[model samples]
Target: MSDATRLVAISPLHSPKSPHLPYNRFLFSSFRFVSNFSNCLKIKHTWSLKPLNQQGSIPISSVDSSSPVSIDLKPILNEPQFDRLIHQAQQLHESLVVLWMANWCRKCIYLKPKLEKLAANYHPRVKFYCIDVNNVPYQLVVRAGVTKMPTIQLWKDGNKQAEVVGGHKAYLVANEVREMIDHEDQP
Candidate 1:
């Protein structure tokens, strides 16, 4: 499936009325497993249950529990309760790197786990975060001028340092980020 299609499949599009129930019902009822021409599975599966906040939406929580190696990409990205991501972004350190992505972006999903692993490896050094451009504030998006699906930015002392505009290879990006961190650690 195309990235856009995959993104749509995984992302729960906003519904004005009965947001949770409708989607839940659709999943338990209308949602069907269809084999594509290439025999690929067309349905998206979300087994983990997320916390529901007072706004009738779910809050994204990090998968930092028992499964340290496993990536909870959804919780890391989506947080309807918070207005700005700077708080979570700041959790890493005074310096941080934010990944601005869209749910329907295939490259984002493919690269998420790798990025998570990199964060796990470099924790407390390079703060890593993922923000869904579709759901985040428009002002920040405009400030960042993010026109692509998977844009990455490095911040130092809460200021913008550098950024990668599009989705690149995970290893390459990780190396670059590591280099940036190492450079900052220098005298």
Candidate 2:
């Protein structure tokens, strides 16, 4: 057989015996030799380029720092801010949407920005807040009955009225949240 063919055939045998110390040492040395040999060879390549359109212009940051920017849409991060938001919503009779999330959760990270954009539509009518499960007190999370990350709950009169466990796609979760808000009056 050719050298390459023999190498391919030996791969399966080597993998099965990888737990053996002697076999592992041999495999490590062989891999290092192959890697070093491969690194000695080099290839040349060329790239095609396109020029920029000089007529196109970019906008500069003209925003005033002194003026209070639009209602800071960032999610509430602390207990005091959370309590104050809930109290204000209760007093105003507005619906409150709290997103129970965790920093390490990929789904939660992706879902958060989408939810924030959605909040803009219901501005002044619905309030949105985010709680990182890792940052907050354990008792608070326990009280909410949050067994999973990215749990979206709608609160009315300081009570949880509806919940959307975001285990599915972002679009589906957004649709569910919208439906929940639309059908808030129903049981």
Candidate 3:
């Protein structure tokens, strides 16, 4: 051994009341959370975890519900757009399903998605569009002779061939709209 080295002896087993213990759990205990409301000592550690997903309000889309076809409507923002689209469909020798809807109308809102799905069945052959009645000029609405909230019209060759006023249940309205489309299609 080097001169600097010091010999150490192993201590015997610690007695129950040993002055030098390895650890004191009480000395390193966690602090209790304090509440802002009062200075009273809380018996339990009061803690909470906020839910990751909260339940509230009407959902924009249905859960676990999906459309196989995933069809959508092309919106006509103005009268000029409406005229151009109708003319285009006429020139191409194809039909257009125009849904005349208003934001405030609950029936219009309900029937729209059903019609969109209906559009999927006629995909590529007949195009589908939506015109918010409020967005277009009143004069154009008068010219089209639309007097109701939800009007589903089938147009071909720059003319409205068939129409269904959808003021009833969505399913019935969808059926009427479908029948109109099918009826207009036949020679």
Candidate 4:
């Protein structure tokens, strides 16, 4: 026989009753190893992926949780509260950040907490309030010129100073908000 034929004859894959047959122990063991390795990779990938909202996933801003710098943002429940807060901020010469949002808006939900956290840095200087456009009257929303779901407006002396239309990603919106706060002294 030729060298090629001799090699094929000695190979278990080419044999009718070889130990490496398709349904034999050796083939089964190889398949089991591959399957187990694939499952292990899947498990390892799952463990490595961390969720954004999970505890310890986000770093705390400061070591002291009870510091005066911590800001507690509350939603404006009604038109009366909205009017009152605006008037109060104007009287106190403090800046007011009014977030025009809708409950059904996914972007609004994600951006709200981030804005609240951002408000902490300007605590006592700026106050943040969330207003669900769905819950509030149509006239109030119209007055604010909120044509979008997550429109963030900086109000001072009962007038709109700077507005951020959150039609983009959360991070970009947050950056724009920070820029607005940073340049708040500009006309």
The segments of candidate 4 whose C-alpha lies over 4 angstroms from its true place after superposition are 1-65, 68-72
- Give TM-scores for every candidate, taking all chains together and pairing residue i with residue i: 0.50, 0.59, 0.63, 0.64
What is the per-residue lDDT of model 1 for residues 1-187, given as tens digits with 9 covering 90 to 100?
A: 4432422133343342453533221121134455666756676544333333323344465222332332233333344423244555556456666778888988877766566766655555555778888876777677766778677777664456777655577767666766766676454
Weakest ten-residue segment in model 2 by summed lDDT: 24-33
What is the per-residue lDDT of model 3 for residues 130-180, given as tens digits with 9 covering 90 to 100? 989999899888988899979988899999998889878998998898788
Tens digits of per-residue lDDT, candidate 4, 1-187, equal 2211111111112243444332111111111112244334211111111112213232323232432322445788888888999899889998998889998999998897678667866776888888999888998999889999799999998888999999999878978998998888897
Q: How close is candidate 1 to the true structure, as a TM-score?
A: 0.50
Clashing pairs in 3: none
For candidate 4, list the clashing residue pairs, or say none: none
lDDT value for candidate 4? 0.68
**TM-score result, candidate 4:** 0.64
User: How well does candidate 3 score on lDDT at residue 77?
Assistant: 90
Give the Cα-based TM-score of candidate 3 against the true structure.
Answer: 0.63
Compute the lDDT of residue 73 as modeled in candidate 1. Answer: 33
Point out where model 2 deviates above 4 Å: 1-73
- Candidate 2 C-alpha RMSD relative to the actual structure: 16.2
Whole-model Cα lDDT per candidate?
Answer: 0.56, 0.65, 0.71, 0.68
After superposing all C-alphas onto the true structure, candidate 4 shows an RMSD in angstroms of 18.4
